[model samples]
Target: MKRIKNGIISLILILLIFVSGIPAYALEARPQITKPDLPFISAHRVIKAEPVYRVLADDKLHWYTTSADEFNYWTGLKGINNDGIAAYISPVPLPYTVPMWNMVKNNAEQYFVTSEESRDYVIGKYGYCDCGIMGYVVALNDAAHGNAQLYQWYRGATDYVYPALAELYGLDDNKWDADHYYNTVVASISSYKYEGPQFRVWSDASTLQEIDVLSPKGGETLTGGSKVNIRWKTMIPGGNISLYYTLNPSEGWSVIDEDLENTGSYEWTVPNSAASKAIVEARWSYEGIDANCYDQSDQYFSIKLGVGTPINWALAFKPLAMKALLAPAAPSNLTAISNLLQLKPMLYWQDNSTNETGFVIERKSTGSYEKLAQVAADQTKYTDSSAEAGMTYSYRVKAVNNQLSSGYSNEVSKPVFKKPEIVIPQSEPGKAGQVNMVFTLDQRDYSVNGVTKTMDVSPVSLEGRTMLPIRFAADPIGAETVWNGTDRKVTVKLDKTTIELWIGAGIALVNGVSTPIDSENPAVNPIIMNDRTMLPMRFVAENLGCTVEWLPASKQINVNYPH
Candidate 1:
């Protein structure tokens, strides 16, 4: 009777295999399956080195293990001795797994297929082979989740199992090939090699966590200086959040707010500058937590020229509106004065407009106004060092903002006169140690060691301070000047004192120490004009052991040596 019972059981098993259209030999070689010990049952399970099974779910392959000891070893979960358990596993590759899992999970729902159907398909085709079953699961999951690359990941294993299954099912080989499943599976496996001994273990399932921008997503035209509310969504509960923006992707990020609470929304005031392509970035982090996430706008948005418009404007009104809002008020009290100390004419104006971005100075020569110089809004004086001697000129001043110009101010006229030649007494033949020099304000000629030489570029007053040509002034005091063309710097050396100044730079080095040009004395900076290097007369002259005196009434600069 026992022999009969065993024979009946064998017959039932064969019938089951035959009904499922799978070969009996495929199940005969299957590995013995065993349940794991009890210790592995936990919210998060660990996996160690062991032969584990991969299961099919919704046509995707997932890690699963029946060994509790292996689970405890991998995930550090403590299991009681002899405690038997079974569970599905989540295999996450450390470090190499990109942080795009949140995106995958959010999109995975659309590709979800019946897990039962996928399991039945695997059992019907590949019988009970663990790897083959998992391969089918992975292929189905790939198809459902739109993960073409993942399908390619297990294509090799699937290809070996597919032909035999088709033969058992009695499906036409020509139709199967025509359907292109065989070709597709073959093609998918081409890019990848099957790396055996793949990791598998059971653990607590992880939830998808990500941040998404709800509003102002992209393609919106926003105005500068206008207030807007930025909205976002995240699975994380509460954490520190910050906002950032960038004009271009390659550039560094500019922080919009650093200490914002993760309240899902922020009120932001747009910047005043206009940009056609802009991106907004949001970052979130928690104290003492390992999970930190960030997101950026998927597409570029625009910051346009208007101050308070959300919609793109009509072409005709944009130009007019931009002009009206940005134009500064005209400057006033424009004056052109002849300086006897220098060959150039100095112009001064009253900055009458509070909103002026900058001042533009224009000179009229031959009845047409020519732009001479543009100065910062705070600057009220400019020297026309390029002006030729013995020429009459008319000057006007105007204010500007964002390339918009205001009406010209009252014009002022001045006549440039040729300076008189200065004569100096010759130095004593035996006196070699001491040098003496004198320069008068508005005078084109300076005396060196009691001898005078004509100067091509003269000393001039700038921002109420006198600037002199360094090459001429320092040479008279026995200081040597070296020009570094590569660095565009001028080095002056005189008796243990070394001064370094760069052209168009505001900082100077006095005896190897950095010193800024005095703000109150704007002329202290070294300037280059028409190939001549000029420096502040007081800074260079006083540092070299000379005393400077100003004759306010006569507008003369007097420098005495050995003081």
Candidate 2:
């Protein structure tokens, strides 16, 4: 009778495996369970180092694990597909272990605990209920023995796990590839949050923690007097960090903040200076070791001169009216700012409406404002690359939807400025008895009366104005030139015209009358080049009764003076 009973039990086990689709060989020995010997803990059976498998069903990720006896006895299991193997421990604490408690609110939002205080605080404050302990994990990173770094990421209310640190948002040290994760999360839900590295656990290999700089992210054109958020991330243990910035790499670094807590972010007020190649660095040091670990921007960014003042966003705002169901409220705090990179004017405003499809931007042109562009809903900023340099423009933004549109916000104007370009008018060839001179940009050799001549300093374009050595420019055109070392002034006399210009000055005197060197570009003025005085080619030559024309094909400037 005992043999018959054993035979019936064996037949039932075989039938269960056949029905559940769990292979018979999958019935491995159950994990050895151990109860915590601590006196404070009570009424518990906690499994240690239990193998856990992640399964997908009903369009949601779920964690599944069971003992060997339970797996053998289970029958007709559906929607259970083993993706990969993972490990977990119990609530009971062990040596070099931390208890990971399960907390739930609406749904499971976060897991992978840090301390009992944190768990209890969330439970009491966030209305989360304690769901008992999930498992224990290694407290510190173990490098000698290979172990994987588990990452916890969540979207909406469901928390998911990644086998490796980089798997979380496809991010690695100095590399940010959020496109795949963004698409996945955005398609499924609206909100996504990243919970940084949790406890280290056993795996095939150990991942080295690194510090990664996340922003200014290179190629950004930041303006002076504006506050910028320098952001970074690190998995290294808590230590004192320092932040530094450099306008030019060869000039060394200036401290933005020193001995700051490793908070991963800092607010910096940009200096009132312009730089084409700017970099930011974040350094982590512990135990008085300088340069222990550090990371900087992967590529250089730019900081340009602007209105050296912060925009009072609150003061710039205009009153808002109640929103109607058909349309959103008008945008507020519209302001246009100028930057040095490409001289593009940046327009910023506050999004005041929730139902608008998009905002329409208009620029004042000719006699009235015209539509410039339309950006998607909730977009409060726009860059006007089409704005002509040296031209002042006014802009306004308004909310719009399919059915209706909101009123335009308060208008803001900004005068865009860019590095000037050499401008020469179209002119006919010089007549006989005229001195014709040709100078190519960046070329030291020029021609006077069709004869080749060499100059110590090259003719170049600076701030959109053509610059040439005063002697080379005026002497070839039958103009007598004099330089005043004390006043840093250059005086050119040709026939009855007299032109006087001061170095670094935007205005020049022509025939004793004050005149701008270049009206279109205010920054166009005289400068010193290679220990020689350089004057604006167009301003000096034209004032001396000469005609100037630009040769685009060969980048040559032609000056003709009637003799």
Off by over 4 Å in 2: 1-432
Whole-model lDDT per candidate = 0.52, 0.61
Error of 2 at 177 (Å): 49
Against the true structure, what is each candidate's TM-score? 0.25, 0.26
Query: Which pairs clash in the backbone of model 2?
Result: 89-135, 89-136, 420-463, 420-464, 421-464
lDDT of 1 at 154: 33
By summed lDDT, the worst window of 10 consecutive residues in model 2 runs over: 175-184
Model 1 bad stretches (over 4 Å): 1-432, 519-523
Q: Which tens-of-lDDT digit does each residue in 1-563 have in candidate 2?
A: 99999999999999988878976567777778998533211111112245434443223433333244433332213433444445433222333455566554322233445577876655433334444445556655654321545555554311232222223224331111111011101133334465545666554322333567788767899988889999988764566677777676544556678668888889998776777767777766432223234677877888878795543222332212212222455776576656333268878776656678899999985579999999998787889989887688889888888766877888878778544222222232445557788899999888766667776558878776688766787765556777764344689998899888866567788888989888998667675542345788988888777899999899999888876
Cα lDDT for residue 547, model 2?
93
TM-score of 1: 0.25
Model 1, global lDDT:
0.52
